[model samples]
Target chain A: MHIQVIPVEGLPIIHPGDLLTEMICERVTFEDGDILCLASSVYSKANGYIRKQDEIVASAEAVRIAQKTHEDPRFVQAILDETTDVILEDPFILSETVTGHVGVRAGVDHSNIEDGMIILLPPDPMGAAAGLQNEIARITGKEVRVIITDTCGRSFRRGQTGVAIGWSGMTAIRDFRGDHDLFGHVLEITEEAVVDEVAGFANFIMGESNNGVPAVVFRNCTRWTGHDNLHFNREEDIIRKALCKK
Target chain B: MHIQVIPVEGLPIIHPGDLLTEMICERVTFEDGDILCLASSVYSKANGYIRKQDEIVASAEAVRIAQKTHEDPRFVQAILDETTDVILEDPFILSETVTGHVGVRAGVDHSNIEDGMIILLPPDPMGAAAGLQNEIARITGKEVRVIITDTCGRSFRRGQTGVAIGWSGMTAIRDFRGDHDLFGHVLEITEEAVVDEVAGFANFIMGESNNGVPAVVFRNCTRWTGHDNLHFNREEDIIRKALCKK
Candidate 1:
């Protein structure tokens, strides 16, 4: 399969109330069967999910954690407001958002936007992706898949790679449970996280820091059948169980 | 930036003593700056890294762990032979290799090959990548970067994505430590795992189970400056620490 990955460029600095779908459509001509990946920070900025640092009043919990993290209490409060579960606190706050996605500081960002304003991950990233997909189709009369991406760190690896926080028009996983290999043996590797794989490549193209690239267009990608169970169940996640033990 | 991702197809089932560099060169015309990603299993297979299952005698520790994992003791012994440290023995075997890569079963694969044989990850993946790069350049008279990829599962996220087991001609990470974002604020996200990002996308294209495509060529990818410090130290990894505590 041959695919063309195009970064959507020439976008203005996003501000509150900006129409992101319209802006992206202006930059990219959507085609049927194209996959579009947008950074979650850009989506949050356009949707006014950013918080002003001076406006937040830190609670006692935020204040206590700030002392440990060496972060501003107001910034910590913003993270606390968005978090559903706190996994780590001292070195850096690792928390789970309401959407079943766990990330550092709940995928909060203080960079790439106006100073004094911090961007929070889309409160409803799945809905955000769906809405954006529908809006693009409405504007361009084309079917395009969407994925909202966040850069995240993983266990064992020192550097972070892009991950899909939410996706639309495709399942998060491509299940190969009954599939057989070349030798006709049942495949041992069952599920593949196809969305994260696509999102990671987009992030590689959309380098962080002044690249002006927040979205990417992947054309001619082959579609597959799968289910959308992206996040692990709390009871079944051994890593989460181990961390909570600490 | 616009990049073309092309999957090289039509290669025969690889075997021991096959010169993979020559095989891949036959299928793809190399460009000076193209990035090629090949599955490590394919590399290991061509380099005769497979082991005959019946030739192994299970050790006592392998037999003990096999009972919990419900696998052949000989298979367990093979995984143990490649593992430098056994991280988990229960539900599945999680271990670290001598190269400092943490993976499930030390990346031993029993699928896609002939029965009674198992495929192990390349013993010296970094050297394998470097040698492959040098061989390709010598054969084609074109400069090409190489990444050896392995499909592996990560913590918190369900399913698996491709990761860079070893890479050449580019740093594993793209560091943006002092780089400023759009608003001139120093970037908070410092390191990006670029090799893994490229590898993950290649794996997405190289679907498992009956898909003949294994290698992908990425053209027109922008370059970045960084270091090759991809693995975390044993003491600094909190998830490893937490797992050890359990």
Candidate 2:
């Protein structure tokens, strides 16, 4: 199967209370089986999750940690407020967000915002993705998948890659257990994170710089279906289970 | 920039001493700046790294760990032999490979091989990648990037995604730290794993099942150049540094 990533450009500066679905619809058309990858930063921006540095009142812990890491105490305080649990303390803060994503600073982003302002991850990423998926289906009358992505570093990898925080209309993990491989052996432990892979492709296209393209549409990804069997709750994520063990 | 992932089909079953580069060239054409993502299993197979279950002589440590994990002692022995350092002992065997990749079972793969036979990762992934890149350049007269990928599970993420074990002809990480975002704020911490992202996209097209497509070509990824600036030693990887801290 061939996959094509097409960036949807011409999206204006997003603001709080803007109709994100409407804005995206005006930019590009959709097709059945097309997957839309949206940057979580844009979702956070549209949902009014931006916070000013002066608005944060740093706690003693934030101040102490900031002194060591050389980061703004208020910024650290904002990250602390967004975090559900701290996974690491030194070099940089890696925390588990309220949404169950383990990443730097609870997924609190510093780029693409006004100076001294930060954007928190959307409160309900799956809900936001579902809402967008439904709106797109209603407008275009075509079934599509929506993957909400954020760029983050992994524990054993150097550079950051995009991962799916929220997804709708398709399952995140495609399990191939008991399936036959080429040699007809029952495949074991071959579950794939299809949405996350798509998110990475979108990240490559939308890019981290001032690309102005926050969304990308993937065409002809037939392996992913709109079936609910693939749908999994975030709480059931293996990463969360592994982190809990740690 | 738009990215297209086209699978190169019709490759015969690879064997030991086979010319992998020649086999690939027979199936597909190359373009300047095109990136080829190859599954590491194929590389291991062509390089004659396969070992039979009967050949493994389980050590006392392997036998003990296998009994605890309820796995075959010989298979566990193979994994132990390939491991450079054991990172995790419980739930699964997460280890640092001889090549410095930290993953499950030192990247020993069981799928796509005859029963009781396993494939070891290429001894030198970067060297193997560079060899393929040079051969492709010789054949087509086009400077193309080659990324050898393997599907592995992450610490905090569910399912598996493709990661670059070896890459040549382009930088793996794209740094945008000094670049400005849309709001003109100097972007901080925006380095991305460009080749790994391409590998993930390739994995999406090369599916884990009997897809028969081991290689995927990506066209029009202009962000990556043939310059050496993108190349960073494996020792410089942040994931390795973080794991060292633990």
Under CAPRI classification, how is model 2 graded? medium
TM-score of 2: 0.90
Query: Which structure among the candidates has the greatest lDDT?
Result: 1
Candidate 2 lDDT, B1-246, residue by residue in tens: 567777899988787899988899888888888899999999999999889999889999998999887888899998998897876665578888867677788888788888889999998999999999999989879888899998888756667888888988777887776788899888765678877788887887887878888999988876543222333334664444444444
Residue lDDT tens for model 1, B1-246: 479999999988999999888999999999998999999989989999999999999999999999999999999999999999888898999999989999999999898789999999999999999999999989999999999999999988899999999999999999999999998998889999999999999999998887988899999998888999898868989998999889
Q: What stretches of model 1 exceed 4 Å from their correct place?
A: none
Q: Taking the tens digit of each residue's C-alpha lDDT, what string does model 1 give over A1-246?
A: 579999999998998899989999999988899999999999999999999999999999999999999999999999999999999896999998999998999998898888789999998899999998999999999999999999999988898899999999999999999999998999989999999999999999998889999999999999988989988867878888999999
Q: For residues A1-246, what per-residue lDDT tens digits would candidate 2 score against the true structure?
A: 567878889998888999988888887778888899999999999989899899889999999999977999999999899887786666788887766677888889788887778999988898999999999988879888899998987766667888888988888887777678888987765688877788998898888879898999988887553222232334554344444444
TM-score of each: 0.99, 0.90
Model 2 Cα shift for residue B135 (angstroms):
2.1
Q: In candidate 1, how many Å is residue B78 off?
A: 0.7
* Steric clash pairs (candidate 1): none
